[model samples]
Target chain A: MKLTLRVWRQKNADAPGAMAAYEVDGVSPDMSFLEMLDTLNEDLIVQGEDPVAFDHDCREGICGACSLVINGDAHGPERTTACQLHMRSFRDGDTIDVEPWRAAAFPVVRDLVVDRTALDRIIQSGGYVTAPTGSAPDAHAVAVPKPDADHAFVHAECIGCGACVAACPNGSASLFTAAKVNHLNVLPQGAPERESRVLDMVAQMDAEGFGGCTLAGECATACPKGIPLQAITTMNKEWLRAARTSKR
Target chain B: MSWTSCGWPPYGRRMALATRDRRPPTVRTLWDSSVGKKTVMAVTGLIMLGYLVAHMAGNLKIFFGADEFNGYAHWLRHLGAPVLHSHWALWIVRVGLVVSVVLHGVCAFQLSRRDIKARPVRYAHTKARTSYATRTMRWGGVILALFVVWHLLDLTTLTVNENAQAGHPYENVVATFSTWYGNVVYIVAMLALGLHIRHGFWSAAQTLGVGSAARARLLKGAANLLAAGLTIGFISVPVAVMTGVVN
Candidate 1:
């Protein structure tokens, strides 16, 4: 297959970025999207030109490291990560436009590589339980209701790929934050710091300059992990409860 | 080791508590974020929706005749009688509605501005993942705002109603709807209102955390019913006047 690629290229954080077009031939349908990019990079390197910079660690979808907005949809048309999206999703002679995640909080580090440290900061603010290291507790020691446990496990699947932030019109991280909040807050061990967890994480999310959730729900749709939109509502309820009931 | 065993609190918890001390009161903090603004919009929107339901029921009194319609309007002022002065209850409701409207409008405006600021660069090829009503919320809100002013001027203040008399609400309603422009304005606004309510109610339920997987379908159904009911109810008054069923 032959394809035309419009990929955003930036030298560094301070450099201005623009869509640079490249044409590559002999692309295999079996190749992954990143593999296709690797082909282009190899061709560029052979010509003594600069290679395109993109972030990818584990080629598997679970790493959440591969972030790309393919044809304006985050991760691609499929509800899966960009790394998992095969070239067959596109037809031969197709023109693909790839861009980095665009959010005020997520600055471009290089071509198609935006700094997602904003998400890390939100996690650092209080996306954890205070359980100490020791002998592992009996699995049955904490009997979480089946429904709650199922809900928490579903939320715990969020990979933090920043696709939700990318797909959101408002660029809100509510879905991401909600996933972390609900994941920990629903469990028995997570209850001790529940009130403070929501408050601190929410405050940090706001400080990061991400837009508010309008319940637009695009984030959930774009999420590669299939994180439910209800995660956000759960977090909102948690925040309301904390704001009302917290002593401080 | 546990955080306490180290003779210190966890770093994140310590920072959170420290920040809480420097932060403003809970109410102010809640008002400062996008989530906070959304909560205000959802709560106030529900309040206005409540009024719409009641107002629609009152407007239906017109179907019974002038005496009943006029009586219903009169009863509004005399509500809470014997315990409170005449019009006191009405005034309280009016004030509450006004406050809710103001908060709803201000929050929506600020949140939109913030949304725009969040995305400075436009996407090369954008795909919409939301519904049409959700996209039209901002413009729908503007139309509703304009309609409210016109509605009050024509009905509440009697400033735009050509045949408006000081104390005859039923007659005033009939007179206004009898004109072509009145029906046009009312119908257009009602359409916008229908779209607004359909999206607003569902959005409010999500914001208020009133829907779960089990109840999601029911909440959405209720939102649709409310939107359709209120739109038809409000539009029926003008349609009846236009057809000379009520004069």
Candidate 2:
């Protein structure tokens, strides 16, 4: 298959970027989106031209490292991650536009690579349990309710690919923050610091200069992990509970 | 949980206290986020929606006759009389509504500016994933605002009402709706209001943390019912006047 790719190119974060067009032929339907990019890079190397730079790791899609907005969607037309998107999704002679995750917090590092440290900062603020290293506890020691465990596991599936932030019109990290908040806050292990966890994570999220959640709900639609939009509502509930109960 | 060197410092004792102390007062912090503004919008919107329902119920008295409608309107101003004073309850309600409207507008405007600032570079080819009501909320709000001004001038103050009659609420309402332009404006504004409430109620549920996956369907149904019922309720008077049913 032949395809025209208009990929965003930039020298660095401070440099101006624009859409650079390239034509690639002999594409196989089985080739994953990243594999197609690899072929394009090989062709570019042969021509002594600079290849497009995009972030990808563990091409199997679990690592959440691949970030590309294809044809205006966070992870292309499919609800799956960029690494999982195959060339067969597009027809022959198609023009695909690819760009980095655009957000005020996620600045373009180079070409399709963006600095997603803001997401890391939010996690750092309070996305984890406070349990210290020790012998593993018996599985039945906590005895979490089935429904709460199920809900927590569902939210725990988030891969933090920054798609939620990228896809949000407001660049809000509400979905991402909510996923982390609910995943732990629902479990008995995370109950000790639940209130403070919501407060600190939300504060850090705000400090990172991310936008607010307008309930536009594009983040959930763009989410490759299938993170439910209701996670945000749950987080809001947690925040409200914490805000009212906490002394501070 | 396994610990990895992910570049961020671990959540430590001092760090938690430091973060907590650094946080501003609860109210200031609450108003700082988009979520905060949305909460304000949702609460205030509910307040206004309540007033609308009550007002609509009052307006339905027009069907009973001139005495019933005028007497109902008269009763609105005279409620709590002898115990309090004439128009005191009405003025309190008016003041509450004005405050809600102002706060809702300010929060909406600020949140819009923030949303625009978040994405400096627009998408070349965009695909909408939200509902039409959600997308058109700002425009719907503007329509409702303009309608409120016109409605007040035409009916409340009798400034824009050409066939204005003093002290006769029923005649004033009928005279205003009797005009073709008046009907058009009222009907159009009612439609906008319906759309606004449709999205606003569901959104308010989510923002106020009252909605859940199990109850989403119920909440949506209620929103639809409220929007449809209110639109029909408010438009019935103008339609009745235009059709000579109330004349």
Quality class of the docking in candidate 2, CAPRI style: medium
TM-score of chain A of each: 0.98, 0.98
Docking class of 1: medium
Cα lDDT tens digits for candidate 2, A170-235: 888899999999999999899877988888888787777788887788999999888999999988
Q: List the residue pairs that clash in candidate 1.
A: none
What lDDT does the true structure give each of the candidates? 0.89, 0.88
lDDT of 1 by residue, A1-248 (tens): 99999999999999988999999999999999999999999999999999999999999999999999999999998889999999999999999999999998899999999999889878877888877578998889889999889878999999999999999998899999999998999998899879888988888888888888877889988998989998888888998888778775
Q: Where does the lowest 10-residue lDDT sum fall in candidate 2 chain A? A: A239-248
Q: Which stretches of candidate 1 lie over 4 Å from their true place?
A: A134-141, B1-24
The sequence of per-residue lDDT tens digits that candidate 1 reaches over residues B6-91 is: 53444442334323444457788679867878999999999999999999988999999999888889888899998989999999
Candidate 2 regions off by >4 Å?
Answer: B1-25
Cα deviation of A156, candidate 1, in Å = 1.2
